[model samples]
Target: MQSAGNGSEDEAQHYREGQEPPNPIAGITGDVPGTAVQAGAIYGGVHFHSHANDEGAVCQLPLAPAGFTDREGELGRLAQVHAEVGDTRQVRLVVLTGPGGVGKTALATRFLREAMAEFPDGQLYADLAGFAPEEAVEPDETLDAFLRALGVAPGEIPRGLAARSALFRQRTKGRRIAVLLDNALSAAQVRALLPGEGAHLVVVTSRLRLTGLVAHRPRFLDIGPLDAAAAVRLLNGLVAGHRATIGAGTFRDLARLGGNLPLALCAIAGRLVMRPDRSAERMVAELDDERRRLAVLSRHEERPVRAVFDVSYLSLPEEAARLYRLLGLHPGPDFDVRAAAALAGIDYLDAEEHLEYLVAASLLGERGDGRFAFHDLLRIHARERARDDEPAREREAALERLFDYYLRTAVAADLTLNPGRWHLNPMFEDARESPAVFEGRTSALDWLATELPTLRALVLLARDSGRNQAAWQLCEALWMLFSLRKHYGAWTATHQAGLAAAEDLDDPAAQARMLVALAGAHMNLGEVDTATELYRRAHELWVRAGHRLGQAAALENLGVADIVNQDPRSAIARFTAALRIFEEQGEARGVAIMDRRLGEAHRDAGEYDAAIGYLTRAVDYLTTTGDDYMASRALVGLAACYLQAGPLEVADTTLGQALRVSQRAGARMEVARVHQMLGELAQLRGHPRSSREHLQRALSSYTELGAPEAETVRQHLADLESDTGEEHPGEELS
Candidate 1:
């Protein structure tokens, strides 16, 4: 008999699709539920009840709602819980917890009232007032109430809380009674009210999960946001006689706008019922404004929309409340543990615990990915609370910290995935406790994919917030985006926002950087002339700023645009001009990059000897600098030049080195390019089968990367099959 806590629900809100799911309590016992669970049939079971009468059962439970329709699942779970009572010596504990207005007390009333025959000794109910605006009902006072209901005369009831509880237990001993502790605050309060060693049942409904009850090994049912279909059914049932007066579309809008919160649904239905002349459309229209939706989602005479939220919010610990408020400030759909840590300015573990506590309080939802989010209405409510309660500077600081954390972490991921991109010097300090850590390039790319939308939104936000330097740097940080990822649209949009921010700051260097990045996006999109104009602007800005490296990089980009235009002569001229400055700067990486550019321009112009000379220099320089990933690319180009010169042996050796280096560096794109070169070389050397295999692997790699070259690789495989008289057209590369 370990004892004590307040209520239960939604520590883990969602689960994996099609997975039967682990014990939902996995996190409380070291299992986490950051990833939310979908709302559906939960903890399946059969419900059975006897039709026998309970002539003398003192049922003080509130009347089940007249409009009550679905809860068949919860009712069945209740019956299952009741059936398990005989298997144990102590009273069976069934605790129901979820968000306020989620209809906990009503569900208990519906279950206990129908299952009266299972508890012949008696059925008792008490509103413990745990989440009441005022102090909750005490355990002692509750025992007094139970004693009197158990036929104890007022004079015979004990004065002491412990004694009265003992008397109540003794009177109900070995009796198959059912006790409903509604609106309970803590397990300790209910612990004193549990029947001792009997086949009796004790059901608890609370706003917080009574985690303290874990010691007693109670069944915890986490009631999620009410199901949408079920909520519609509920609204339809509530206004049954008035259905013709309600619009079907209005009910849908109402259910969605309510976030399927049963309490809100009930309130909406109640409004329709109260105003028989009103249409569901009219009422839903009233509830449509997010800012005032909560206020309007109320019962005719009940406390307004935020009343339940107020009571629940006030009931939480101060730290938990602060976390809840600050978390709402994050402008993302959902956020991971690290972001939560930054939002609260707390340790990651501490932030997680705070999130758990808020979940327990039914304020936040945990998704399966270890991320925490809330229903939109709750989010809006939290934001309103933060604005009303917190100081302006505090809120702004928290937002800036969150912005800084995401920018710094995302930049780190970008560098990990695309190290060859030019890095911008951050003008602001990183506020994150720890930057994001990736296991390898694959994981870094995955993180970037997941955060893409959030980062774009933040760039726009940064620009709007007057954080011009941060906004532009954030855009420039993804400089390798056009080459590595297939996010051309996002590439253009983010840089556009950054360009505007750069103009806002009146910073010429920032403008130059933004222009070059935008030009890269256009160059990738095949708008060579547009790209040239942007790069020209960037080169001019760099010239005006006297930034030699910037000027060289801009010229190099212009050369890349010219290459895409199939004007290798222009590309060679630009690369040559850029090379003069690159060599003067004497950075091996920069010089190697220029060498690769010059080699590629020469290769495209069909000058194999010149390609070999420049490509081999790039290979040697990049290899000495430990830039094996880019070196692999240089080596592949050098191999292609060797292939063009009819030196199969040298080409084969170089291609093998490129393969190993790229594989070791986890540069799949470069590896794919190497395979493409190998396939062509093998085809020329009369290795038809070998050519097919290399082409197939290259196609698979290109397909996985969403690169357009997959189609070319496919055509190559088809051509190899055709010439060899081997038919595997769709079979090999499709």
Candidate 2:
């Protein structure tokens, strides 16, 4: 310590005397310690030294992928992780895992390039070739490269793996660097290259799970295949210079055929680019065949989607591979373990284990809530595997079991949601094996909402495959979802398919049911005239089939159409006749629903007293029955009556109650309607700010639902703004 002080004091004296001090290290030259050093120096001796700090920050990040599209979500997640790991002692490690050709490396590179400012110490990149045909790069090689990038002299670098790792940590201490270890083979490979200390960020992209990085507290992000829109964009970018013209629909078809994988889409785009004279429509027709689709997507043999998928598929354990192949036969968009078990003819525990294994291997993805789904391309590859490897009988049996599972599960959900509703499908009586259980109407509706897409697809599949009964029944089972959730597109499409299936079967009652469902969809879509025609046809069919309940249901739907058409007198007559039929049939719920309809009609007719009486009775009955959704509608009607009459306070209280009931029941339409009424009431009370707030909330809800009422709420907000002379008003009053 004394000798160190004496040397430093002597150097200080030499500096004060206006003379340079001797270099402390031999064969070294620099201005002074704690001062900037000049760039570019050469040293030659047994012992050589250079100013390590003279090197500029290493900017080793590769150019971001060309035509990078729709990774804002992943980039945002990276930003969030960076924000959360602020200034921590431990280095932040983010592992991006997904199947090959899923664009994990592109996402990582894009994020790091955009985030360069965060790492002043600079960027480093290494490609380990984890899933390539060649052997993966070793960790020691990556470490060596990283050490050199960090400005370590060649002679000073350690030879042993442990020493290199320790030196890397020592070199990176207190430096904020960003290291991208691309195509990593394992957690160990990634670990060896990670910065040993400092608030650094290390992002690793790998096709494998790399679960061994758990001790490092790595955040794992799973990159999935591009969506259809992004896939089309990628194709468009790749083929921008080509003379070939493709229609939007043809592009979408190509994207679907390619399973929206970026690699496959690029190949498709390459085909279009190379053959500029070829028609995309013809290309789509050729790619539509599953057997040839993979071949078409293999235009780029270097990174063919099929070959990439084969590598992942071949690496899977035997049981997981078998389950993955059978999952290709699953008719639904996604599946749970129970459905997988049904497809594979295995038990739940085994299915879960296999599915987990596939998920880890990136052959499958967990779709939340204990469900798993394959990437579309992986699904196609799995289908090809099943077609080639599995016997025809086995494939057919797997599909049949999956279809049965979906059918029985849909029926169970239907009966649970609509207890005692008339169902003509014989599948209701068929024994269900391991059907999904719903605790109540809410749970049933939730399940229906989540599975709506799958259900719609299966309905079409069944209809096309000559499973007529299954088709119509699946449509009928979806009635509750369509009625409540108001997915008008799915409702209309599935019912049209169901109607065709019904006609094919020549069943009058089934036809009536499908017509009613289709009419409801049209009614919600503002096609009142079309809805009315459908309802009348349904009523005629119900009469022909001698089904009075169906007849009453049709009458009620027609009354709803009448209300929408603003013909209160016609609505009243329709509701009155339907009410009588419901009463005669002892359908209490039907009667309450009719009462609500009558109340709505009376409110529009300027008969506040009659509306109040009808709506109050309906609300009391529906509330007692735990039908909060219907009760909220009736309450809104009652509130409108009170608002039209003289009791503003009662109207406000009623709307508040309706809002709570609608929210609790998840009746989004009713919730929006209540907000609309509240906005009108606030307007009437000269509370412009309050009116604007309520109307804006209503507008947001309606806009999200794609409901026409959004326009009404927007008009309300506009009028309030005009009346108050406030272009943008202040916060709401108490």
Candidate 3:
């Protein structure tokens, strides 16, 4: 049988006021008429009573606050745990741990008192006094108190701590007693107190994790600071008549000022109710300063807030203090051990130990998933400490390291995001090249998408650091991901930063690239004027650099924008210019792309023969360059032109060629477009069933691709379904 430390609630000064004259403990008789009894049991006093009256009569173990509202979820969890008893499924040990003044004791007491029926033998409660400034009660003393509760003779109690605990456990071995051990010193202190065997359920509450005791197969419940809603509910309930007098705003302000801590909220509510006339608003205004927390709390004649925090903080070791300060420097919402270790310049194992210390001190939180975070108020408190304690240069160094790490990682992610985009100079040159990582194009792209926000933050950080080259390079690396994902807002912002950085560096090539990225966003948004302006500026920059490839890219983009704006003539002129630049540069890829655009402009202008000629040239260039995907698109354009010119045989042959190339290239969008064309051809030939099938396939492909043409394909499919009296196979067009 396991033994417990000899700590008793009777020794704690934080207990309710006044020592009561010895009263009968069993079957509480009518409030003793002005006897002014204490809230919980008074140890070693003349309060003992026998259950000889009948079958185990009701015995009040502790006075838990009634209607302990708003922690309904926690209460339910307690009930669920209590229900786990009696099935030999292992006696459940739940640890409710948190910082001082977070109401761990109160919550445990309430849960145990309400669940007393489930543990009929009796309920044992003790305060380990782990955080008390004075001497803590010994395990032997606490075991003696438990023996006295079990009707053990004073002289008969064993002198040995282990023997006394074993006898105490043996007494309640068969009978289930719910033990609530509060203010636990450490895991070792707690291990001695746990009862042997799986018959008794023990719930230990402490500020520290007590992970050592966790190995005994106890489920841990890490209690954090209460949220605003629960804190306010707890506070309002403590006031006289339990009428919730605090206004919503005042309650919110009080909850926040109390740091959403249950004990603090309780104290504030008690003070407010006692005063009656003083407004919570004025109280909140007074408690704004961290330095004045104690003073402000003392104004209500309740315990000081700073004192409570100090009791928790002063219990920690030196390592925990340093880690707390380092944690205060983190700007992210949560952190992991690796980052914490990096900040402390320590090994991961040492950092984890220090982290547990801070968690014990209530300065840090270990979430259910094992990630760490600080309470918002504690975060603020730590940051304040960091500002006062840590050197500015040191902090800046840490931040820079963090920023650089993210920048390097994000740049690595970019290589996979777009395997096809050929950037002139490598981005993030200072980042160590690790070609062994990223594995494949898909892996890189997935990483980039997942880390996009962090990458964006790093870009901004680089810009803020006056690292203009890094800023521009960061933007460039992310170009393909941003473009393909259609994150136009981020695309625009990053490119704007890149544009300024490029101009600062006086790099015309970088300037052209930035404008091209910006213009892509504008083009996607259908802002032709903005797109044209950016494209023209990019073209000018490229021309100044005499970069034919850059000039061709800009011209092609400009032509596409013009075509989207319905300025077909201007688009044709721009496409022809781009084609000339590409041909001169021997860039077959660029030439093919420009030829396709030129054909589209000519077709839109009703010049079918000219469109066919340009498309044929585009297809030939794409084919020679082995760019079957682009070749397929050019062939589709060729087929459309021939179909418009009434050459059905030529159209059929061109369509077949496009279909084969598109299928081979695995270009789903192009494949869908080919199906759409065939569907239209089938409709013209009066083959309703075939037309419906092709159109439906095209719509399905577009939907899968999330392509803009999905809606149009669905519309065509609906029309074919309607013509064939086939129940409109597609959903309503609108």
Candidate 4:
């Protein structure tokens, strides 16, 4: 859709003396000097809203624990703390500190649920996993998730902790939000997430008191074991049907044996509920004996929770028990049915059944998203059981299956998104099983985004476990996602590990791919020098390996680096070389892509005619191939050439087409680029108000994406304002 032109009759009269227009096209036929150029009347009707109103209430809190008991006094204390701090502009901070299995998380979850009405905007929750065997969740990772929940697109999210932290604060600044930071390791992690100048409530749970947060004046609530009466009530609720059979006195005995801890009490109750035929007296004796045995073995005071875990785990069916042990080796924070099936080497239905059984036993928690996770103490116990019961070979085999599953599934998703892209990984054939099927591009990208963190962990796990091939292959499979989402942190970390793994395996092709991928991240982040070095290294490797496609890809990357370095001549040369290889290989898509890049290089060098020829050919080929995303990009470049040359009307039309196509393809970044060029075109036509409108749209989109170009656009807007003085009536441009 095009907007109407504001050219007055006088302006049209001035154009009447114009010399012949630069290009020959359908709309223009000019001869006499200063004659009116008969470009068709500016078509106007389409209004595009690139950014939809998707930022609404984001409720990320998981379901509260069932049968929550006691803590009336603690709840009152929380209310009192909120009363003292909630009215302030600063974020209200509360720390629930206690030992593991002492119900700290349960307490926080319960309090937040009850206090939800005060935070109408929504709640955010994250498990820091401070005490888990794996690395603690980093603040940047949590911030990324939080920002996405708050409606920040993945590509729009900034890289690095500071930028992301600042963006998070900006997004949540005035929202009355509630945040629960579970199992936090340190005050630093908590501090990075504090919202800016809001009446937000932030609740943190940790085993340590987190005295480091004392400066924030956090209201520290130290949770302990539930009172005896409360523990009895919890047991009574969980094992209601069996309470009569267990008798009233036995409930107290069981609660005492469980140390009145919620986790232990739940486990004890799970055993009672599962075996309605068994008497509560017999269950208490079994738990007490296990506690004594563990105490002796540990050479410490009695471990009631571990004892309870042991009893519950021992009661599992053989298949369920095996699945539980194998799950301990899972590298991710949580897992779905498919992952569980892979880990246990069982079919999906069987794995689902086993997982449900584990949940019923209180050894696992349902995430309510077709996934499951274990409590910190329960996870530790499961790992211990796997170590003690399963053989080393069996454990390794289960892990291998998991790695294969992820690699194959990720490769499937990648191919779905970019089927024609060259790939070096053999996992597409070597890894067995049907990879996860995605319905389309949107679903494929969604899956990739959802599993990114787990996939990153798996890459490290594969590398550390000596599965070098799988490690590098996983990185290769993730290339599509990194390119689309621009998750720079994961992109850098995984590629580094993948590069190391390739080196260890002495695979030159794999190493080259990893280097090129890593370089792309640096290039996007504006580290052109670093990117150039990496691309050079990769090119050398590709040449040595005699991989023509790899060589071409590397050369193309070098061309991009050259452009970023402001060496258009060198970029042109590099693109020419890459184009030659693409033609030799008969790769039509690659050829078109190189042509697009060449057009950009020429445009930067002010060779507008050559740029237009290259860009038009690219646009034609890409459009014919139904590659709307690349076609939209080429159209933008073509319009930029038109804007620089003559025929501003043609530039406007081309931009309208580009905007429509980019929106159709969901290419937000390209859409922003088109808007930016449109803004410039409007300014050239003396439509100052229209220029500001387009420029503002560009700035907003660029800022959301955390692109460095945002600053340039902001400067452009500042200059426009300076030039125009104040807003005035002007024709709008589409």
lDDT, candidate 3, 1-734, per-residue tens:
11122334542322211122122232233323211122234233323222222434234356776636567677788778788787543567888877776777778888777777777777777777877535455655677777677666675564544445555655555666778877776665565566645457888887766666656777777676777788777777777474436688888888888888776676777678766777777778876776665456646545565566656665556677767876776656676686677777778899899987787656787877666887766766676666776788877776666655555656666544433345755653433355635675456666666556656665666677687887787788886576445565677787888888889999999999999988887776667798989999999999999888898898889888878888899999988888898778776677678878889999989998788788888888788866665677788888888777767767767878888888765556678888888877766655667777888888887776556678888888777656734343442211
Q: Judge candidate 4 at residue 439 and give its lDDT.
A: 78
Per-residue alpha-carbon lDDT of candidate 4 for residues 335-384, written as tens digits (9 for 90 to 100): 89999999888999999999887765456777767888866456667888
RMSD of each: 11.0, 12.0, 10.3, 30.3
lDDT of 2 by residue, 1-734 (tens): 01111234453233222243443332234332221111123133223232364678998888998888887788899998888657758799899988888788888889889889988988889888776324567556677788777777666554444445555776777888899998876666666677757889999987778787788888999888887798888877777877656778888898888888788888888788878888888899889887778878886567887888888787677888888888887766787888899889899999989988788778888976888887777888899899888899998788788778777777888777555465677666552344547777778788889888888988898889888877888898887677667887888889999999999999889999999989877777677899899999999999999998898888888888888888999999999999999999999999998899998899899997898888999999999988777788898889889988969999988998999998877788888888888888877776777777878888998888778778877876776666835433454532
lDDT of each: 0.75, 0.79, 0.69, 0.78
Tens-place lDDT digits, model 1, residues 12-96: 1111011111222212222222211111222323222122233476767677778776878888888888888885367789899
> Model 3 Cα RMSD, Å?
10.3
User: Using Cα atoms with residue i matched to residue i, what is each candidate's TM-score against the true structure?
Assistant: 0.77, 0.71, 0.67, 0.60
Sort the predicted structures by lDDT, highest score first: 2, 4, 1, 3
Least accurate 10 contiguous residues by lDDT in model 1: 11-20
Clashes of each: 25, 0, 7, 10
Which segments of model 3 are wrong by more than 4 Å? 1-73, 87-90, 97-107, 129-145, 148-160, 183-185, 196-199, 206-211, 222-385, 420-425, 428-433, 461-469, 496-512, 540-550, 579-724, 727-734
User: Candidates ranked by TM-score, best first?
Assistant: 1, 2, 3, 4
- For candidate 2, the 10 contiguous residues with the lowest summed lDDT are 33-42
Q: Tell me how candidate 4 scores on lDDT.
A: 0.78
